[model samples]
Target: MVFARYLTPAAECGGLGLQCLGVGWQQVSRIQFDGRVIDCYGLMMIVRGTGWFVWGDLPRQRVPVQAPALFVVFPGVYHAYQPDAGGWSERWVLFNGPSAHTHEVLGTLDRDAPVMVLQGPLDGMERVFESLFEAADSSSPHRDVVTSSLVHRLLAELLAVKATTDVARVVRHFDEQATGPLSIGEHARRLGMDTPTLRREMFRATGTTPKDYILRTRLSMAQRLLLTTDRTVAEIARCVGYSDAAYFTRLFSRRVGQAPSHFRKVGRPRGRDG
Candidate 1:
C-alpha cells in the first residue's frame, strides 16, 4: 500500500514566523536512504517497524526503532536511516525559518542525538501535521496565523515528552500562566511553595524572579503572536491576558520597541531592534 501527503507553506507564512516547509508519510515495509546535509530540519516517526540508524563515519547502530518512535535530522547534518527487512511505517514534518530555533532553545532537540522514542500513540503528530497541510492547502486568510499556532503547538507537544526538570517545570508553568493572567502567589502555592521561597529559588536558578520571569515570558509570547497572527491589538492584548488593550500596547511597545500593530506589518523596526 502507498500513502503520503505534502504541503509547501505560503510566501506570507515564510515572511512571518516558523513556516511549515513540508510534511508527509511513508509506509513502505522495506526502505533505505542516504541523506546529505541541507538547510532545514526533518522529523520521522516510525509507526510500526524497526530500522538501523546510520550517521556519517559513526559505526552503524542497529536502531530497532519500535513503533511510535521518532528520529530527528537537523540542518547541515548528514545522515541515513534504513528500515529492517520488516520495513517501517512513518509520518514526518520538514520545517525551517528564523523561528526554527524554538526546539534548540527549549533544549528538547540535539544534532548529536537523532532518535526519540515516543511514549504515546503516533497519530498525534500526524494529526497536527495534517492540520498544517490543510491550512497550507486552503490558503486560509489566517494561513500564517493558523500555521504558526499549529507548528508551535506541535513542537511544544513533542518537547513535553522529555522528562521534566526544575528549569523545564518552571518555564512550562511560566508559559501556561503568562498566557492569560498574572498570579505569583497563586502559582507559587500550586507549585507547593510560598511566594518568597519560589522567588528566591527561581532567582538563584535563572537570575530572575518569578514575576520578572513571567513578564518576559508574556512579552515573548506577545511578540510571536504579533508576528504570526492577523489578530487585532485589542484581541491579542486580551488573548495574552490583558483586559486593558491600551496598557498591553504601551507595555509591548516599551519592551519590544515597536507597537504591536506596527510590528505585525513591518517586522522588527529598522535600527530600533530590541
Candidate 2:
C-alpha cells in the first residue's frame, strides 16, 4: 500500500479556485466501512478489485462497484463503501473550492451519480497521479499551485473521455447562440429536449448546466470584443445579450475579478509606438 498524506495549503491557494487538501494511493483488504461524512470533496479511483457504495440522507440504496471506476464524496453527505470478497486498489484526492462548489451547482460534479465508470487505458491518468504525489510531497513554495493544476488536469482528462456526441451538439448550439437573447429553455426546445434532460446531458458532457455554459460563451465573446474592438462597455454588454451594462459589470467583476474597462486596459499590450 502506498503512503497517504493530507495537507494544509497556504491561504493564497484558495484564491486559485481549487485547493488540494490530501492525496494518496492505497490497497485495502478485509475493509468494511459503515458510513462517514467529510467537509470537503473527495474523488476515489478504483484501479483493481470490486466494491459497493451508497450515499444519501438516510435509508440509502447501495451501488455496486468494479475496477476502473471513480466515485465522488460530497461534503456533508453521508456515504459508505466496502470491498467485495477481494479488496480494492485505489487512488484518492481531497479538494474543495468555490470553483468546485460552482461545478456542483451547475451539475457537472453530480451528487446523484457520484460514482463513474472510467474508460480507455488508464496509463495517462496514473502518470498524472504520480505527478500529483510528487508535487504534493514537494516542499517548494509553489507546491500548492502545482498540485492544484494537476488536480484540474485530472478532471479535464476525465471530461475528455466522458463527453458524448449529444453533449457536443449541445455545446455547439450554445456557442452558436451565445450572443443572442435566447433562454436555455428555448434552446432546449429547439433541440427537442426538455430542460431537465438538456441539463442532465449537458452536465454529463461538459460538467456545466446550459445556463452556465451560455453565460461563459457570452462572456468569452465579450472578452474577445473588448480586446479586438473599440466598443464601449455598454455596447459590449448589449452585444453579449446583457441590456444592463451595470449588471454585466457586476457579473464580469465577480467572475473575472476585474471590471470590463480595467480588464481591457490591462489585458491589452501597449503599442511600442506609443
In candidate 1, stretches whose alpha carbon ends up further than 4 angstroms from where it belongs are: 1-11, 56-62, 120-126, 139-145, 164-274
The sequence of per-residue lDDT tens digits that candidate 2 reaches over residues 117-179 is 666557767888889999988888898999888888877666554454346667777888877
Global fold similarity of model 1 (TM-score): 0.52
lDDT score of residue 185 within candidate 1: 84
Candidates in order, TM-scores: namely: 0.52, 0.60
Q: What local distance difference test score does each model get?
A: 0.69, 0.81
Taking the tens digit of each residue's C-alpha lDDT, what string does model 1 give over 108-138? 5655446766664445567787786677566
Which regions in candidate 2 have their CA more than 4 angstroms from the true location? 105-107, 164-195, 198-274
lDDT of predicted model 1: 0.69
lDDT over C-alpha atoms for residue 192 of model 1: 41
Best by TM-score: 2
